[model samples]
Target: MDIMDIARRKERPAHRVFSAGFYGGSWDHDVRSVLGKAPRGGADVGEVLSTIAAVEPHDTEAWPTAWIALGDRVGAVAARAAERGHRVSAARAHLRAANYLAVAVNALAGRTDAEDRLQAVFRRHRAEWDGFTAQSGWDVRVLDLPYGDGTMPGLLFRPDAAGSPRPTLVMVNGSDGSISGLWCEGAEGALERGYNVLLFDGPGQQSMLLDQGVVFRPDWEAVLTPVVDVLLGRDDTDPAAVVAYGISQGGYWLPRALAFEHRFAAAAVDGGVVDVSRSWWAHIPDSLRKAYDKGEKEKFDRDMALGFKLPGGKAAERTWAFRARPYGTRGYAETLDAVSAYSLTDALCARIETPLFVAAPHNEEFFPGQSQELAAAVPGAEPVEFTAAEGADRHCQPLARELTEQRVFDWMDERLGR
Candidate 1:
């Protein structure tokens, strides 16, 4: 039976957190992550909803405080469990604490002294996660990849059954996700399938952007080439069956990398993005669009700055401020230039010789129609779609992750003979 034909929820709950606007990316994602982690003792759904009820939409200041408080409470539980030598209980609590702290850190508006507490708290919880994983007997190791001048932090997870070198999955994160977060996103599923999983933070992702000060670059191939080289050099990886998966903005990055780096057996994207600037431009008001079209660049910039300062523009302010930091741009105008340059030309897509799997969710808001457009551009690209009817319609299939992983790995298994 066709997956899209399955019936699912048609409407979003009206009172749901951040249902009305684009605040701190997506509040629905925050809520979903919280609820999703409940199975792992990461959250209490009722308590989370109660906390959500206290904060107004787009309230970044209040958002972090509420989540962090809950995270701290969970951290205490983890500490007590650790003292009692309850390894399983401690690990579960630690993982949940780390998840909550991640959401708080991610919601931060910009890089400032005010964000230091949130970042520090997140770091502490992440450490707790590391300690828990070490005690839990999971075949996971923290490693740093050599990059230009500095190293990119990563985690390598080997399946428990170890004999012959297995098909390894190298996963690259999107614009805002952490290496730890990607585990929940797909690494856990990949490991369960007996594939060694490597989750890395490239330029503009987590530590690289926040700590290393490595800004985003349009030519993602430059960043990924070194990653591929390092992973292939590892003994546990099967050179002939290695596959790369890119999520969120990585959808664009992975495809761009595959165009030039042909060592990979295959590449897959959770969502495809052809041109980021075009999508950003679409979100701009028509008045600003007219100014840009009329060649009044300075006027357009001024109006954009004014828009953020106006009433009820806090969400816009927070979003742009967070985006600009990754590019090290002084302001939104320069950020736009950086984003505009990030486009996968049809010529470039046609150069890719590797098998490509493109997953397109029907209800994607950020980059609608992009997956199909990319599929059409790339020769023999296998384009698949997740529909609202199947309840996997949102970006990256956050709610239907198991189904997403199943479909993606099934495709990879077939192509790579795993």
Candidate 2:
């Protein structure tokens, strides 16, 4: 068994002022992107904290407003820097401003409609991020990948290093994250190590869900196949050494993709998720489950209706609704049905032949012990458990991202013969 089994996660209030776990984690976690004075002189530590201090936690109505306020302040700094011909300074400020606004948009929870002001903030986030990459000497490309009928937005980061063909890491986003979120998570580190990085929103992910209404499906191969086609066909990619790295829910997504798309040289998941249904089930009350199991769809829906309506006000409603999109179900029964199908049967797990790395952190509240289950199911898949003692214990180790990145990429490097 993985060491994660011995390190049980701590319990916290369901609708508290501050949250730290993944399922309902706090918005403050985004500050990890700019922690320790990020943007190198562009982001003021005191100012960032001041922005955070302005709002009350679990206030969804006020969430986006506070974030936009902070974003605008930082954006002004970016504008001034650009005007003064301070390219590097402007780039850093723009990057920080973009991150701030991205979190702002994310904080708007259930308002996933493109016509909403939330989308406008996200558009600004992308624009500012583009400004940052252009000035940072990073050769980043914004392209559209051919998916089903239309296209999926993608960001490909080619290292400035000169090499005929370079190893590339294709980063996959999790349940509630975006490509922009991937940049601060692990993409920057991958680029610095002379590895090309690619980030894209698959079905039911980010803009795909919001703008296109593409719900997520269990058959991940359909999405990954085209992504592989785009990456390998590029002249700069080393076809033999492409690695698939999935984050958050992508832990389930990355391995699932590799199970069918064997062309990838290696694959890694920050937190391996063996069964989404199991995770969701563990969080629900037994009474609700019994009703749902009995196929009492209407009763189950009525009983679970008030669950999202917590005393925390609008924040509670938005938070639950935010999580509802993944299943794309109308009611509680359909949600269970949808999530029940989001699992890799033993047969599928046994078929995964690519080298695999599973990072299971202690105190992982979201999907504890699933990593060990994944490793045990797959042939030769390695599950590396990180302990709270090492300061790498939360979901995806967001606060300790550097440690997770080093371990994951190093394993990938060795697997790809880098």
Candidate 3:
């Protein structure tokens, strides 16, 4: 089934925690993300609310500054707690600080000094994340999984340090998701359920994009195959029970990879995505789309350039830059053209033999109804729906991590017979 065949939702009023127009829907969703983590000590409700209150909606500078300040403050608290030998308290605080710092890093996008600020804030986020994992007392092992010409950085977390084979869940992050965000998404829950969790920064993700300048590739099988190789080499990973779980944009990458690499016992995407370019296309005008279709790259670029000079065009241009940077493309037409390659065909979907689960959530802001389309195209794929009634809708059920984890991990457990 083609993604276009699925019906798209009309604009309708939905519940929101905040409605700051300048910051956009992504800002509100990011806020809910931290708050949702409070249950698992990834954040504090009071701290997140207080930080949000300090920022002025219209002041773009205020956004990153406030978050950086909050991150600094919490980071210091974590340091102090660690000094006092309060390991658990220190670990939780470190996670919160890391998450806040990541928020700041994200807010730096589109700024004149975005690259500098991103590098600075992202380093702090990475430090705090490292501190949390080291102090949390979990059985965590740092890994260097081999990739094309380099190695992808990863962390493997087990229930204990005792070397014993166990069911493992490999967690793949979405575009622009921080390592700390992965903890709230599924890593923490997986550990609690006696599942070994592996988290990594693949191409165009965090360290790879920022530090190594590695861009995203559509053939994600090239990424996951190496990950599987590393997992199978570990004495602590169960060869028969290794599974996969991905969220957000990973919804596309995981399925794309599984179509070629079939070693996973089971796999679940918080939502399924068939055509990743649809999200990019939604923002583009039909005129430009037509130009691109006709291979008129120069005309497409010229029209886009003119569009950015109109009222509110600067902001649009900034957004385009932020989204396009990871694609390793500078030209407007080139980036869209690159992203359009990230779609799955019926033949590719048919190649997937692994047990697949797809989440179809209400009000999926990006790639609406793509999950249904993906499930329909893949034979024997299971599709699960999350509704606002369950407080588990939107892109990744950001505000309902517990519910999302429960349903997803439960399916995984059943599939792995654990």
**Which stretches of candidate 1 lie above 4 Å from their native place?**
1-25, 37-47, 111-113, 161-163, 293-295
lDDT of 3 by residue, 1-418 (tens): 2232122111212333322111344676778777878878888989888887776444567878889999999999999999999999899999999999988887786565677878888899999999999899999888999999889999999999887999999998998789898998889899999999999999999899989999999899999999999899988989999999988899999999999999999999989999999998898899889999999999999999999999878767877787787889988888987998999999999999999999999988898999999999998999999988888887888778889888899999999888
| TM-score of candidate 2 against the unseen true structure | 0.87
Candidate 1, residue 146: lDDT: 79
Stretches of candidate 3 off by over 4 Å are: 1-23
Worst 10 residues of 1 by lDDT: 1-10
> What's the best-to-worst order under lDDT?
3, 1, 2
The TM-scores of all predictions, comma-separated, are: 0.89, 0.87, 0.94
Candidate 2 stretches greater than 4 Å from native: 1-25, 28-45, 111-115, 161-163, 309-316
Cα lDDT of candidate 3 equals 0.87
**Global lDDT of each candidate:** 0.77, 0.75, 0.87
Model 3 clash pairs are: none
Candidate 1 TM-score over all chains jointly: 0.89
